[model samples]
Target: MSNKFFSVSVTNISVAILTTILISACAGNRIVNNDAPVEQLQDLNDYDSDGVIKAREKCDNTVLGASIDNYGCGNQITKMEPFKIKINFANDSFAIPDNAYDKIRVLADFLKENQEIKVVIEGHTSKVGKVNHNQTLSEQRAKAVVLVLIHDFKIPAERLDYIGYGFQRLEDERQTEEAHAANRRIMAELTHTEHLDEMEWTIYSVDQEL
Candidate 1:
């Protein structure tokens, strides 16, 4: 054969060999038989005979499935619980009664023990006055409890929040003296914040491309 023809033949052979090798490599990486069982398929992108691709799931896999959220990741959900106290105030007064001090102290102790737990002092009032006046009174009642917890019991002010619902969230909505007394109250709601950092990580991981 001529030298030019021989060189061209060799070049064509090399190109064919390279193309075959590339095809083999790609085939080796994929699941060849679509009708194969799930156990026979390998890797995350395996497809079934119906052309449905399998999903790859990543989970926290903690004990009792505690750390898993709806997306199967370690997302810590902050839970809140009521403090075991029945804080009642006299009619038309925002003062924290001396009788309720002991219960407030119990709440303060809980805060002191669990520093990571913050609290919201919710104040409510009876439906006996104008909307604005009752709202102000409820706010004062919540603030009074907050001040007591911060100043008297030495709980950190940063860990405390207060809100006034006034007559909007009455315990008993009857037009009776007892219902009004029951409505004028303060409640402590404990919030968990220790897992917030882990929760942020979970959110970021979800937004990332696989």
Candidate 2:
């Protein structure tokens, strides 16, 4: 074979091997994005001279693909403010149901795209159990969601925090399961007060070097 053909074959083999490794490493935590490539996510910053998707724009999600000016953040996009998305759990369990996946996916994607946002996922529980037990469960549920975000969604760990509010933050004291269920949820807080790019962390120098 010619050197060019031989080199192409070797390159293809190497790419395949590397892809396989990546897939295996992330298999257990991968989320299914029907539109995303099967192997990995395309960088959200793809753009053209005119700032359009290479082809006609089919999305309103981000601007990068088409006529987007700010990494697909739409014109109406606001900084990640203190927003709460509730994830309900079955009685006495912290297992996230299959139905809850999409919400988590959107959250993970949002956090990934906006680095200035730090989140505190507070888990809450109804008053059915002892206060301590409820607190522990609530914290565990929040951590569980964090783990899923890290392992499956590839969200960085440093950007997340988990806390159990127990029944302390309950919405109401009604005795019905429906009311209790309402109390069992995860609420997110945006810790940074400024826009991501404008937020700064400063380090002060001591008078003497340690």
Candidate 3:
């Protein structure tokens, strides 16, 4: 009878030990899963500042013969002439008029055709408003054009640059409203001129107002 009791006790002990071992293994696996390092999620399809998505680009979209920097952006290999393309804005506004569409289309086409030529589109305003206010408005106008190129025309962002000069860089400085309207404009400057070293324009002096 004592032997029988001893055997039963030993069998129960073995079963308890086995259950504990199984539970410990499951706990270990849970801990490992909880502590596993998570991989950072990179959006391959997202548009970069230059409006190019690396995932879908066939060409590396990098300047040829350029060296890559620490952040993987490339160095400039060639100096291009700044091509000037100007678009006048409506009175005190940057809204694109229907008449302006064709000209914008042409500019977009030109930029698309010449992939190597980067453009700096500058926005300027007349001297009617405060200088600081004009500067901000001018920048917004330039950015508006950029949006059109990037979103509507699918122009790559790398080919575009922008700045706002406000009333500081005007073609004319007549105090009349008509002159102010004429002064408000968006203009392009090519970063690298394949054929020329520089571009020339008749920039009016901002010091004197008619």
Candidate 4:
């Protein structure tokens, strides 16, 4: 071959080799960067922007129009009113009456459902007795209720507290029997550490295969 023709052929071969090397280098960089292909990255269905995959959500009967959390469970604001149950005792007796069982059951159910709520049981007595005697009677009444809650109703002892108010804070000071009966009572006050409506998010894990 002539020198000029040979030179042209050599240059063409070099250009082809360089082009192949450049393409290979770009492919290698993509592999090292671990970039997923466009088809693999694209979601097949419309997903919620709230970070929850609908198919993987575990909660059912979610409230409509309410804001959902990361688990697709809607936020619910449970406002519980303070509950009170009065158990009237016969004069000088701390025994729980049969009628008080239903009220105690209601209180137990409430405590069971709301585990975070703590209750204080206050016992009060009429002013017909001496200060020390009344105080002891009041304490016994409060403790009796606590025992029933813990043993019969399976309420946690840690969530309950009792105090005896005795005749110091009488609900009624009248000399009538009805007023005195009202004063001999047990009061349960439920309190929470935080407001029930405070915003909290539910966290859940999704199955990657789904």
Candidate 5:
């Protein structure tokens, strides 16, 4: 009767397992190409090149290379020069003042240069004449100025308007010669919205700059 025992070594088992692992690892090694979806950089492209990228650009077009703000939009501004034209007249006349050509020419040039503003030719009168007569005279006087703007200065007819104040808006209540002369006059006035160029690119300062 003999008792025989075979001792199993863990080192041999480890060696065999290591060999299997090496073979499996070698078999798993193969060239694999992954066709992944690459993101295109077109989103960052700016078509107008107005310093704002396409993703966040509000205004795409920059007019006349004008100045722009952060949102790729342009700043628009308009200014009316302290413009006024006064033409005095005789006691009962709508004729242009003798020394008013220079002012008229300047007015014409201004109207031509600035096509955005419309003007109203205002006529006033002294307190001496009848109310109805004064009103009619003032109306004629205003119309005369409007005609000058249209014919002489080439200002558009649509851009010029006429209104007469007569004795209603007398410059002076006194009947003095100087005061009467001041009252009997016509003047040009321009009124408009605060922002002249809303969507366009423009910058101006009335009486501030040329």
Candidate 6:
């Protein structure tokens, strides 16, 4: 074998041409449209820009910046509110008073909006009266309020129930006018489930790399 030495000098322009050739060779099947290589790394199938790809995404059109799950659904949330309404009645009356109409209407509106809610209208009386008489009066008071809800506000019959607790669950045990007045009242306990989409917490942004 003969010893042969070859001297090769490459210019900057020649080196650049060789580099472009190597890059083109590396991208054998991939289309090169003068775009950056980073585009190839991004998930182009994700149309909504959510992390989940189109084939796997269960939810579509997910809001941008919403903290989405693996299924790509976001903005679905649940909420609960502690609601109570109190309306005091006269010494020996079960009438829905003029002044108490606004609060009752508000309660009705709440019920109208929240279809899943059920309301319990409770009635109580002072200890000065006989237990049996007070119980009957309490029953009347609660029933009166419930009727107003059903008739006036168009509240559904199935969503309402009345209960009497005459002198049993007194707000104050003292034998004073204020205590008696406070004890003689109608109360509504509200229960429901609330869900909101627009008012949800999030931890995502467009600034982040997809």
**Lowest lDDT 10-residue stretch of candidate 1:** 45-54
lDDT of 1 at 195: 43
* Per-residue C-alpha lDDT of model 1 across residues 139-206, encoded as one tens digit per residue: 99999999998889999899999999889998897999999988998888899955432423355566
Per-residue C-alpha lDDT of model 6 across residues 1-210, encoded as one tens digit per residue:
323322233355678899999998988867659665554554449888767898778888877655667778754444444355667788889987798989899889989888988988888899887899999999999999999999999999999999999899988999999999889887887766543324234355343436
RMSD of each: 13.9, 28.5, 19.2, 11.1, 8.4, 9.3
Residue lDDT tens for model 2, 1-210 = 899999999999999999999988898686867895566444444343334443444333342222334432233334446567677898889999888888898888888887877888889899997989999999988998999889999888999998998999888789898899898888777666442222122342243234
Best TM-score goes to which candidate? 1
For model 4, the superposed segments whose C-alpha errors exceed 4 Å read 1-82, 196-210
Model 3 deviation from the true structure expressed as Cα RMSD, one decimal place: 19.2
lDDT of 3 at 174: 70
Query: In each prediction, how many residue pairs overlap at the backbone (N, C-alpha, C within less than 3 A)?
Result: 0, 7, 6, 0, 0, 0
lDDT of 3 by residue, 1-210 (tens): 699999999999999999999999988884434676777575465233333456444335444333334333544445745445456676567777667767778889997887877778888888886878888889988888887888888899877878999888767767877777678777887765343212112243233333
lDDT (Cα, tens digit) per residue for candidate 4, span 40-79: 5534332544445555564544443336655666544444
Estimated TM-score for each candidate: 0.59, 0.54, 0.52, 0.55, 0.57, 0.56
lDDT of 5 by residue, 59-166 (tens): 776553546677777655544444557676888988887688787888788778777888888888999869999999999998987887788778889888889988
Q: Write the candidate numbers in order of decreasing lDDT.
A: 6, 4, 1, 5, 2, 3
For all candidates in order, the CA lDDT equals: 0.78, 0.75, 0.70, 0.79, 0.77, 0.80
The top-ranked prediction according to lDDT is: 6
Worst 10 residues of 4 by lDDT: 196-205
Give the lDDT of residue 157 in candidate 5.
Answer: 93
TM-score of 4: 0.55
